[model samples]
Target chain A: MLRDALLIAGKDLRLELRSRVALNQVLPFALLVLVLFAFALDPDRGLLARATPGLYWVAVLFSALLALQRSLSVESADGNRDALRLSGLDPAGIFLGKVLAVATQLAVLEVLLGVGVAVLYTTRITGWVLLAVTCVVATASIAAAGTLFGVVAAGLRVRETLLPLLLLPVLAPVLIGATRAFEAALAGSPSEGWPWVGLMGVFASLYIVAGVFGFGPLLEES
Target chain B: MTTEAHRQDIDSTGSNGTRVLGIAALIAMAALALFGLVLSPADANQGEVVRILYVHVPSATVAYIGCFLTTIGSAVYLWRRSRWWELVAYASAEIATVFTSIVLVTGMIWGRPTWGVYWVWDARLTSTAMLLLLLLGYLAVRRLPADHEVRTRRAAIVGLLLVPNVIIVRQSVQWWRTLHQKPTLLANGVGAKIEGLMLFSLFVGFIAIGLVFAWLLIHRFRLAWLEDQLDEAGLDVAIAERRAEGAAS
Candidate 1:
């Protein structure tokens, strides 16, 4: 099962490598979001610093949502999703592959978002390690949630309309945690945000396990 | 021998819907509305705004009931391979979403006077919104055009998965500090403000909306079955046309 999962993941990664879809579109989209934020807000340093964390997270989340929309759409548009299911590939393996691809895509966008926020707003960072750790936790949570919901949404006729409604509620916990962690990291306040970071870890782990277990029959039905 | 048994199954299921549940629902709602509006005393703090509770609380109760029924329907559908259970699930979900929206709106109206804001990021309100969205998603899945069996199975799976997510939405306020009021009622404790008459009214309201939901379920299921019959008829026509063309050729 692990071998199959890895092969599936590898295949998805190779697809992205060849297409460079994530690199070409996601990073640019994130940058454009940041630019739009800059345009919306006054350039006052204090105000920019105050709003930077939220702006950064929203940019990343929206960009990730976009990429996730594409990831699932790709599988379904070409009938690859049905093909994958019929190929005797484990549904869990498909979920894992898709999640990994989404996580990798989001992580890249998060980096660009972080750089843009830092440069635009001049955010002060206290603990680099904590920042890095929380980013990974947030990424995993978003990926797991997006993949699980993306599959369900993809099966619907009005998938694009239904995706956000299905995902945003489930994604709230992660969003809250990520915001707090990001805010703390920006403020150099370590103690207050640690719990939220821990919670994000829990959310990520639960989603991954649940998605893998639940994806099997869900995909079959879809 | 089994042909007669099959015929009976079809006949009963086809006709005996809505008559019983619908009347019961109407009676229950009329009794509950009168009791809630006329009998329940005004709150000490808020006077007329307190009346909104009759609408808000009942709506919330019905939504929860709807979600619970959906979960049960999903389980039954998956376990028994019964399309009837799927229809029940789909019908209940639509009713649930409607009630949830009513609850959220009434809560906001009540909050504006009491909290001095139209809305706040309170736990109770936020969770209810999340619940509404989940229910909407469930209902949307049911409406998607696909193979009937596949649609039913997929929706049942989504409905099954939804049961656990509600727990998160319920606890989100407690898990994080928020402005929303804590649950007014729970298993271990009684609400301080709840009077005997108010409690009774609430109970009546619950039963009333519940009956209405039950009635809606039966009626909607009948409609879904009618749709199935129409589809079958269409297929029969198509098959007949194909055979006629072949014969002519």
Candidate 2:
């Protein structure tokens, strides 16, 4: 199962690297959101600095939607879904693979966004360890939940409109937890942030397990 | 005889049992109103605003029940691939969405007089809002155009995800509220001392709402069953018509 997952993850990441969609489009869109936040909140008044954590995660969440859409859209085209199903790889492996691929993309996006926030919002991260843990856990949570719903919404004609509607509400906890943890880390208080990381860890594991068990049936149906 | 039996199956989405349940719900609702509004004494703190609890709390309870039913129905449907369980999940989800909406509106109404705002970032309120959104997501998936098996499978997955989502949302929101050190105004309003009639009113509210929920569930499930039957019957008719046309040509 792990080998199959690695094989599928490697294929998706390679496809993404070739396509450059995430690097070209999603990355820019995320940075634009950060800039837009600065404009809306007025960067000069210290509001951007105060609101950086939330705005950063909000940007990431929106971009994650795009990434998830992109991830699933890959399967939708050219009968890839049918091909993948016929290949006899374990469905659970496909699920974990897609999650890993999306998480890897999101991790890179977060690094850039961290830089974007630092450069644009003049935000300084005081708790580097706390910040790193939150990003990894929260990204896994988002990717797992997103990949799960992405498959659920995959082949439908209304998938474009339906994916966000289905995915965003389920990711509410990740948003709140990640934002709170980011706030704690930025405020130089790692103690308060650790618990939120724990919460995100719980969310991440729950959805990962859910995705594993739920994916086979969903993949067949979609 | 088989055709007659089939006709009887699809005839109506009601029965004597549902009629009894409907009448019982009506009586219970009436009693709830009397006990809640007219008989129950005014509270020292909230006074008239406390009456909304009779509706709000009961609606929230019914909504949670609906969520539980959906979860069970979805899980069973996935396990057994039973259309009956799929319909149950779908019906319960729609009903849950309605009650969750009611809970939100009534909660806001109660919040206005008690918290001096129509909305607050309190954990319960935030979590309930998210629950409403999650239920909406489930309904949206159910509405999407797909083959029956495909749509049912999609809806079941979304329904099954609700429990975990609700738990995480509640926990995260609670921690978010607490970390900010914001006072939970709802704690005071609901935790206040309840005397004889108020407690009785609340109890009556529960029975009334639970009965209403049962009534709705039965009718909605039957309606969904009828829909499935109609779709199949329509397909059969279409196939026959096409064959007749081919024969005539």
Candidate 3:
């Protein structure tokens, strides 16, 4: 399973490297959200700065939808899904591989968005450790959920319209927890953020286990 | 013969018992409204507006029952692949969404008269809102085109997934709300002192709502079965057309 996971991850990552979809498309979309949020909210009132963590997370959540869709859509074409099924790889491996690959892309998306907020929203990171850890944990949580839900929406004719509706509500806990954690961390009371991090970790692990155990039957459909 | 018997049991039209449940619900609601709205004494705090509690609380409890039923239906459908269980899950989710919406709207109405605001970030209210959204998503997934029984399998998985996720959403929302600078007005609105007719009224509300839920579930299940028949007929037509075209070609 681990070997297959690595192979799948490598293949997806190589696809991203060759195609540059994340760098070319989703990253800029995240930045555009930041820019748009700045326009919608008063930038000088200190409210935007205070709310930067949450707005950033929301942007990341929306962009993650696009990444998750691509994660599955890639396999939908050129007989790739059939090849996957016939390859005799464990479904759990394919599931994890997709999560890992999406997480990697989202990690980059978060960093770029992180820098954009610092510049555009005038947000300062007082507790770097808390912020860093929240980014990692929340990204994984989003990726796990996004990948699981992506498959749920994958084969449907209305997949593009369906994936966000199915996924966004489930990821609310992540958004709430991670946003709260970032708020606490940016407020310099890093202690207050740890519990939210724990919440994110719990959410992430639950979804990882869900994807592993739940993917068996789901994979056959695609 | 047993499979045929089971199929007949499920596929049969609505029964006389459904009428009984419907009548029981109306009677219970009339009793609850009388006692809660007129017979009960005014509260020292919020007065008559507090009577909304009877309907609102029952909406929440029965909604939770709907959630529980859906979770069970989702599990059994997954394990047994029974058409009955899938329909049960689908119907329960729709009923749950309706009751949950009632909880939100009625709570908002109660809030305005009492708290002078129509909304608050109270944990229970917020969580119910999330539950409603999740239920809508489940219903949306169920509406997707039927191919390979895919809708049932996927929706059952989502319904099952929702059970655990709701718990997590509840816990996280509760924790998140605590840090808010503004506290929810009437946070513990319903748990305050109550006795005599008010308490009994709540009981009547429960019976009323539970009966209504049963009535809705039965009719909704029959509707879903009818839908399944339509889908099967539609698929057969498409297949026959394809066969005719292929033969002509």
Task: Report the number of clashing residue pairs per model.
Answer: 2, 0, 0
lDDT for each residue of candidate 2 in A19-109, tens digit (9 for 90 to 100)? 8999999999999999899789877888888888899999999999999999999999999998988899999999999999999999999
lDDT of each: 0.76, 0.90, 0.86
lDDT digits (tens) for residues A31-78 of candidate 1: 888888877887674676687767788887888888898888778877
Task: State the lDDT of candidate 2 residue by residue for B91-111, as single tens digits.
Answer: 999999889999999988988
Question: DockQ of every model listed?
Answer: 0.50, 0.81, 0.65
User: What TM-score would each prediction reach against the true structure?
Assistant: 0.86, 0.97, 0.92
Q: After aligning candidate 1 to the native by TM-score, how far in Å is the CA of A166 from where it should be? A: 2.5
Where is model 1 chain A poorest over a 10-residue stretch in terms of lDDT?
A: A42-51
Per-residue C-alpha lDDT of model 3 across residues A66-151, encoded as one tens digit per residue: 88888899988887888898899999999889888999999988888888888877676689999899988998899888888888
* Model 3: per-residue Cα lDDT over B1-249, one tens digit each: 995985676675667898778888888888888988889887778888888888899889888888888889988887887889889889989999999999999999999988788987888778888899889888888888756477777888788888888899998988888777444455446777678887888888888888888898889989888778877877899999999999999
Which residue pairs collide in model 3, if any?
Answer: none
Ranking by DockQ: 2, 3, 1
Q: Flag the better candidate by TM-score, 2 or 3.
A: 2
Stretch of 10 with least lDDT, candidate 1 chain B = B182-191
Candidates in descending lDDT order:
2, 3, 1
Chain B TM-score, structure 2: 0.95
Cα error, residue B215 of model 3, in Å, equals 1.5
| Candidate 2: pairs in clash | none
The alpha-carbon lDDT assigned to residue A175 of candidate 2 equals: 87
